[model samples]
Target: MMNPESLRTVSVMRYILPLREGGSLPALAEADDDFKYVLKFRGAGHGVKALIAELLGGEIARFLGLPVPELVFATLDEAFGRTEADEEIQDLLQFSQGLNLGLHYLSGAITYDAAVNDCEATLASKIVWLDAFITNVDRTFRNTNLLVWHKELWLIDHGAAFYFHHSWNNWENSAKTPFALIKDHVLLAKASKLDEVHSEFTQKLNPDVLRKIVNLIPEEWLQWEDGSLKPDEIKEVYFQFLSTRLTNAELFLKQAQDARKTLI
Candidate 1:
């Protein structure tokens, strides 16, 4: 279980450079703690909702013993990024003032290459299960969103998970989805232990555990584009979506099992 107090908020000190790998244009930045971080701007494409998913997904993965970079609430000041040369980057920083999401930067980390690296069945299964539960659609071979640092696999860029929030309609029903996207998971071929990990992961993620992770979302990040729901209500929806999905894990587990069968 993640302690509510474990997530810290740090102020962004400097904009180091833009990581152009993804459309969101997340940047490498330095924080007040004097450590480098990969900063996800709230002003980016998906906006705060993406940040919300990052917090929920990353924390939930950590709760399940997955190796994720340390997550923090990074605040951007208005005066920062004034000297940037790029017009696109300058606009991104200008609109991205206020709270954002940051992942502790792992120096000398290389992207996970399934073709070259070997992953045990157990770890692969756990990762597939995590992506399935969150309805992540970005972990396909084309964009693995995984990093290997010091020979340890570290999960990153969870902003693409929990995609149901992109449209708030029928969120409860969304929880019942089988998340067919699991078919494209980079680790699907090696995830032979999905069933075993599903049972163990479900047990570890009780209602209390889910609530603690959901509660980590900052109120500022809860602004709905439709303006129909308040912050607390929005949080409740996320909690309900996750909890209901947990109760219906079989739906996605079956989908994953069937997908793996085709791959193997």
Candidate 2:
């Protein structure tokens, strides 16, 4: 399990370029550590909730022993991006002045190509299981989001996970619901060991592990439009949802298995 304190905080030194492929306009920026990171702005179209999902989903995947890029708390200075001629990007940086999420940039990584690179059944099963558990709906063929770096598969762009939080109602029921979108998963046809991995994976994500990951969420990110719940209350809801989802893993596990049957 990742030490909850291991996630480092860095300051954005320079805004390199915008990665337009991402709907949120995440940019490649150099941090004070002299390392490049893909910065996800809190003020993007999805807002801070996307950052929260990125942190939660990425950390959970890391705890489950999946290959994920290093995630960090990236602080954007108030004066940053002031000279940018583009009004859109400048406004984004201005609005996202405080805190953001960054993924260590994989310099030469290529998008995962299912047609050329063969994925092992065990690896595929674990990834599919993780996505299903988190209710991630973005790992389809059109946008695999999986990348290959140094010849190893790495997961990225988890901001789309935890869709239930967007509505913030009946969250407990959402936790137990099957992820019907699993049918479109890039790895669904290859995840032959889904059943074999279910027990072992579930054992790894105990309550303590889940709590540590949820606790990593920053209080600022929890502020919603209506402000009906306090930050701590929001954190507790995330914890409860994940814990309850784990208890009902069978619901999604069976769904994945049934979905796979239709494919292979």
Candidate 3:
């Protein structure tokens, strides 16, 4: 398990360029640590909740022993936003002045193509299981979100995962909801070990690990507009949601297995 306290914090040295492909409008920025990262601004169109989902989902990927790019907290200075002439980008940067999420840029990485590349059954199964567990609906073949770096597959762009939290009203019931989107998962056909992976991950991702993952969210991101729940209470909500999902894993596990059988 990754130590939540060990997450590195780096200051933005320069705003390199904008990656306009994403809805959040993430940018490639050079950080104080002399490393270049794809910065996901908190004030982007999707809002801070998207960042929270990314952190929680990405950490889960790491915990499951999947290959994910290193995530860091990139500190952005107000001055960085001022240098941009684009009004929209400037506004986003200005709003995201304090802290944002950064994904380490993988040089020479190519987008994953299922047609040409062969994924190991175990790795593919693990990813399928993780996406199913987190309710991530973005990893379909059209937008694999998987990358090939150093001859290894790496997961990225997890902002769309855990979407249930966007509207927390029915979160408890949502946890037990069946993940129907598993049918379109990029690795569905390749996930031959779904049963074994499901059993192992269920046993490994205990409450302790889930709590540690939820604790990783910065307090500022937990602020609710209604102000009904305190930060600690909000964290507990997340823990409960995930715990509920784990306890009700059979529904999703069966869904994935059924999807795999159809594909094979």
Q: Pick the candidate with the highest lDDT.
A: 2
lDDT of 3 by residue, 2-117 (tens): 44444689999998889766568899989988999999989987788889888898998888778888999888876777878988889889989888999999989999999998
Give me candidate 1's TM-score against the actual structure.
Answer: 0.97
Tell me how far candidate 2 lies from the true structure as C-alpha RMSD in angstroms: 1.1
Higher-ranked by lDDT: 1 or 2? 2
Q: Please, what is the whole-model Cα lDDT of each candidate in the order they appear?
A: 0.90, 0.92, 0.88
Best by TM-score: 2
Candidate 1 C-alpha lDDT tens digits along 1-264:
444445898999988998886568999999999999999999899999889889888998888888999999999888877899988888888888999999999999999999988789999999999999999898888989999999989899898888988877899899999998899999999999988999899988888888888888888887666778999998899999999999999999999999889977
Off by over 4 Å in 2: 1-3
- Better-scoring candidate (TM-score), 1 or 3: 1
Looking at model 3, the pairs that clash are none
Model 3 weakest lDDT span, ten residues long? 1-10
